[model samples]
Target: MAYLNKLRLFIRKPFSGLCDFNRATTAQCRKPLPIWLRRDIPPAGKIKRVKGILAELNLQTVCVSARCPNLPECFSKGTATFMIMGDSCTRACKFCAIKKGKPAPLRADEPQAVAQAAQRLGLSHVVITSVTRDDLPLGGAEHFAKTIRAVQNQLPHATIEVLTPDFQGNLDAIKTVIQAKPDVFNHNVETVPRLYPSVRPGANYARSLAVLSYTKDFAEKAGKRIIIKSGLMLGLGERRKEVLSVMRDLRSVGCDVLTIGQYLAPSPNHHPIVNFVEPEEFEQYHQEGLKMGFLAVASGPIGVKLRQHCHCYGQTAP
Candidate 1:
C-alpha cells in the first residue's frame, strides 16, 4: 500500500510556478532542473582563453573537477577556484561530483603554478579549494599553506580565501593552514546533522563545528584577525528548523560569513534532490542569516551570484 501511494504521487504532474511535491510527477518529484540554474551563453573566445591559461599552468580547478554549474559563467570571467593537490578526492561524499579514488601524487610545483595563474588573471581576490586528501599525514594542510604563500608572493595585494576540508578534526592541521593567514577561512558544513549519515557519511557535524570554533580561538590567541566562513545546502531532505539550527551553531562558533544554496544532484546515481526550494524561501534565509549576526549572507537559486557576493562581501568586484 505504501508503494502504491508513492507510485501515485510519482505519476502526477507538478503544479506550475512552485515546486509542489504533492502533485509532482517522478521527474518533478526529482526536482526538475530550474531555470535559475541555467546560464547565458558566454563568448566562446573568453572561455577558450581561460581554458588555455589553466592548461598552460597545468592547474586543476574545483569548477572543472566538481562539475560546478557555474563553470561557463566563471570561466567566461576568467575566475576559478584553484583546486590544488589534485583533481581526485579521498572521501566519497554522496552529494559531490569530484572523482573518488586513490589520488595521484601531489605535484611539487603546484603552488607556483597556481600563483602564476592568479597573476595572469590579475585577480584581486583569489579563492582556493581542494579535494579531501585523507591519505596525507596532515590532510594536505602543508600543501594548502604553500599554495597560500605562493599566491601571496605573486600578488601581495590580493586577499586570499580558502575553502577547505575538516582535516578529520585534526586541530594541528587546521592551525597549519590558519598560520598561513588566509583573509577568509571557509569550511562548509554541507548539510544538517540529521542528513550527515546519508549525505556526508565521511564527515561529522559536531567535529565540523568544533573546527570552526577552534579556528576562531586560535586566530585570536595568535593576535591575527581572520574572518571565519561556513556554508550549507538546502533541498537535501533537511527541515527548515534544522537549517536555522545549523545557522545558530555556526554563529555560536563566531562564524562571520555564510552561504546557502539549493542542492542539485550531480548525477542520477548520486543523492537525489528532495525538493526544489523556492526563491522567496532563499531570500527569507538570507535575511534570517543577517539577523543571526552574520557579517555577510548569500542565499538563492542563482548560486554563482550568491557565491560571488559572499566572496566579495558586497565590495567592489575584483
Candidate 2:
C-alpha cells in the first residue's frame, strides 16, 4: 500500500539532509525553475551587510532557518523575519525545513539582541517568529513577550508583528503574548483540516483556529487594536473548495489579513509538492480573500510571504 511505498522511499534515499530542497528532488533538480516562481538573482553586497549584522548580533531569521526562496531579495532590502527561541523545533512537522529535534537552551539575551538587530537594520516594521519549542512550560510565550517589549523599548515607533506557535492552544499562553500588544498577532493554520495529520502532525486544526479566535477576542476586551492574521500553503493536493472553506473559517474568527503561497518541499524526505498553483488561480484567491473581508491579501507564487502587505495593515504593497 501507500505506507509500504513510502517506507521503500525512506530506505532508499534515507534523507541524509544533504539534498537541495529549493529544487523539487534530486531527480528533478535540473528542471528549470517555474516561470511563475522565478526571480532575479539579488546583489550580494547588501545581502552580506545584513547577514554580517545578524551574525554580530547573534540573531537568527526565519529567512535563513526555513530556507525561504525570498531570502536573497529580502536580505538585499535589509529586512528579515527574525527567528527566536532557538533554531531547533520540538515538533516534527513534515512540511517544514527547520531541523526537528531537541532545541538548545533559550538564550536569555536574545530578546535584546533582536531589538538591537532591528534598530541596526533601521526597520520601520519588524516581524518575529520562532521554532516550536514544545518542551518549554509555556511554549516560549514569555520569551515572545519579552522580545516584543525589548523591540518596543528600542524602537518605539516601529510596528511589531509576531507569527507565533499555538502553545498547545493554552489560553494563558495566548493571553501572555496578547498582553504584550504586538501590532499584529499571527499563527498560521498552514493547511486544511484534512491535510493536518500528514502536513502538520503535531498541530491541531481546531486548536489553531481557536488561537486566532481567542487572540482577537482577548485583544478586543483588552482594548488593543491588534490585528489577527493567518496563512496557508497551497499545492499540497488541496482542493479549491477546501482552501475557500479555510478562508471562511478565518473570516468567521475575524482574521484581518491573509497570505496564500505555494508549498515548496524542502527535501526528498519532506512531503512532495503535489502541483504548482497557477498565477491566475493565485489572483482568484487574492480577490476572493478581499471579498471575504481580509483587510489585506498577498497571494502569489513568489514573495507572497515577504510582501509588505502581509506585514502590516493599510500599507500599500510594494
Best by lDDT: 2
lDDT of 2 by residue, 1-318 (tens): 442332222222211111112313223323345777777779899899999999998888887787776677778888888999988999888778788888899999999999999999998778889999889988999999999999999999777889999999999999999999887788988889999999889999999999999999988888787867788888788999999999999999989777788777767678878888898898899889877778666677666443433322333344
Runs of candidate 1 with Cα error greater than 4 angstroms are 1-30, 304-318
Worst 10-residue lDDT window for candidate 1 reads 15-24
Best of the candidates, TM-score = 2
TM-score of each: 0.87, 0.88
Clashing pairs in 1: none
Angstrom error at residue 10, model 2: 44
User: What is the C-alpha lDDT profile of model 1 across 34-130, one tens digit per residue?
Assistant: 7665556678777788889999999998777766666666677777788898888989998887889989999999999999999998777788888
Q: How well does candidate 2 score on lDDT at residue 5?
A: 33
Model 2 poorest 10 in a row by lDDT: 12-21
Residue 309's lDDT within candidate 1 is 33
Superposed model 2: Cα runs more than 4 Å off? 1-32, 305-318
